[model samples]
Target: MARMIPDNEAKEILVLYYSQHGATRQMAQLIARGVEQAGLTARLRTVPPVSATCEATAPAIPDSGAPYATHADLEECIGIAVGSPTRFGNMTAAMKYFWDGTSPLWMKHALAGKPAALFTSTGTLHGGQEATLLTMMVPLLHHGMVLVGLPYSEPELTSTQSGGTPYGASHHAGVAGELPISEHERKLCIALGKRLALTARRLNA
Candidate 1:
């Protein structure tokens, strides 16, 4: 079992996500940066990609990027920021699968009342960015997490032609995932991280 720790000592927020083709992963890193900018630790974690064969399984440890997330990470963190690429106006199967395994946490009310945030990446501007974000909120809501979204006061929400939304931070990757993260999208991502970190801090305080 993981060692017990008081909430006062859990001064970090979790930036948990799953990325394919790397766009969502880049956004996750930016969010983690923003979280640190808010003066709290950001615990970066990722879920293993799901495979078709029930016989197939990922190695216990990932070869690179953030480590595979553990339930303890969720239990210890004061807040959470989850991300994933769009999958038909909803979260990817991998992200949904990971959340599905958290029934134990839900039974414990482990995430209730904690601050939560969301982000996503899509292949096209009209590719269900808002829908994915909104749907992503369902599981968090079921966990009784308090959702936080971007407010229009953030100037980029009004100006970004690419990908900044009041729903949450987002990025518009090209069809082949060739386009780089735009300045506006990057700003919104960082802003989200900062906001999530700040909210987690206050909740813990």
Candidate 2:
């Protein structure tokens, strides 16, 4: 039997997300933990809240928790795992708005060939968790990223009653975002992160 050799030059993986009610943030942290478990560093980042008014702007820095993501962060990461709460069966406007600003990086092909994964939290079991994950991958695909998804081989996908999908990890947060992440959902999240990191490391090598 051959022993596996780990990549020695793996770049940091970025776990970026936007959460209106904090559920998605918790999922991001769990994914980050999974990435670290795979022996890769995780750089967590969040986007600023969007405003309905045309002239409104967020402060230069967030009040607490992860800092706002920048183009530089995207450029430097080797792998990326993005998460957002489902909004009308798609990613939130804040996350969409953030990706809209990445044209420069796209043009430069800064993210080409990198490994990327998606995750989401929804208000209900049928609240389009899979659609949100698929939709979130569009921009990343346009940027030429390699999409990483959870496989059916993961037992949680077959057994989970709440939220776990082949598209990516998901959580059912209920209408008020009051539901706790189920045991299966958490395991799936960690699995997604670990798989993503391992894939990125191999590809980078």
Candidate 3:
């Protein structure tokens, strides 16, 4: 069995996500940066892409970016920020798959009362950004997590033509996936992470 992390160890905010074509991954990195800016450690982790073939499997360790998340990561985290690209108005299969397998954590109430946040990226301007963010909250809610969202006070929510929303931070990557994250979107993402971290800290304090 894997050893459990000690409660006395430094607290971490788990930045968990799955990205395809890298847009969502970029957002994840920005959120992690925000988490650190708030003076907490951000443990970046990703879920492996799901393959159609049942027998096919990813290598135990990813070749780059964040390491694959473990149950321990979820259980030991002070808060969580989850992200994924839009998949028909919902989180990607890979992200959903990861949460689906966390029944053990649910059974133990491992995530109950912890603060959680969400983010997403989409290919087009109307491509279900808010829907995906809302749906992403379902699993977190099932885990009994306290939901956190971007409030309108964060000016980006009112001004962004791209993908900043009150539900959570988002990015409009364009249909060709050619566009970079906009300045407003970036600020909202960072703000969301910092907010989540601050909430976790106060709750634990």
Candidate 4:
């Protein structure tokens, strides 16, 4: 497959996610902003939703939003930040489906030693935000990725009533999924990206 990104640059960080109602998408954009602020390029990519029909397939190009993520994206980026709306305290099936096909990369250790971070959005304040974040780390660990997470020094971790955690950045959307991302949650998302980018840069250097 052709490269989605230019070959010269090795400073790009991949922001990969699957969003159902836009909350996670917003968070992904904010994270990208942070990554840019830290002097790295952010390659925003999304996975196509998994369909129930065995033969159903997505178009080569997405109708809107970021283009679908390719394994090449995972291999090309120096770092990655993964996001998803929580599903029963775990990543959405679509997100899981994307990672499930990455065994080829795992075999090659393509992502080993790369920095990775996680972010998640939930339908309720008590929904599985932290659990989703923790579970998301499993695949990255399998690939030998160095996990990056929010530190207590961010302040938002202690102050945020909505959603912020040491596990990773998180947002507590209301039951209707209408609540805006809280200020603390937004800041933490950006911080996570910045921290991940900085870590990746240092490791790459």
lDDT of each: 0.89, 0.89, 0.89, 0.90
lDDT of 3 by residue, 1-205 (tens): 1123455789899999988899999999999999999999999999988875422257879998899999988988899999999999999888888888999988888888899999999999999999999999999888899989999899988998899988889999988789999999999999999999999887887
TM-score to native of every candidate shown: 0.94, 0.93, 0.94, 0.93
lDDT value, residue 80 of candidate 2: 91
Clash numbers, per candidate: 0, 0, 0, 0
- The TM-score measured for candidate 4 stands at 0.93
Q: Across residues 97-189, which tens digit of lDDT does each residue of candidate 4 receive?
A: 899999999888889888899999998888988889999999999999999999999998999999999988899888888899989999999
Ranking by lDDT: 4, 3, 2, 1
Tens digits of per-residue lDDT, candidate 1, 22-131, equal 99999999999999999988999999888764221578899888999988889888889999999999998888888988999998888888889999999998999999
Worst 10 residues of 1 by lDDT: 1-10
State the lDDT at 153 in candidate 4.
Answer: 96
Clashing pairs in 2: none
lDDT of 4 at 117: 95
What's the true lDDT of residue 199 in model 1? Answer: 81
Residue-wise C-alpha lDDT for candidate 2, range 1-205, written one tens digit per residue:
1112245544688999998899999999999999999988999999988877522267979999999999888877788999999988898878888999899888888888888999999998899998888888899999999999999889999999999999999999999998999999999999999999999888866
Question: How many steric clashes does model 2 contain?
Answer: 0
Pairs that collide in candidate 1 are: none
Off by over 4 Å in 1: 1-10, 53-56
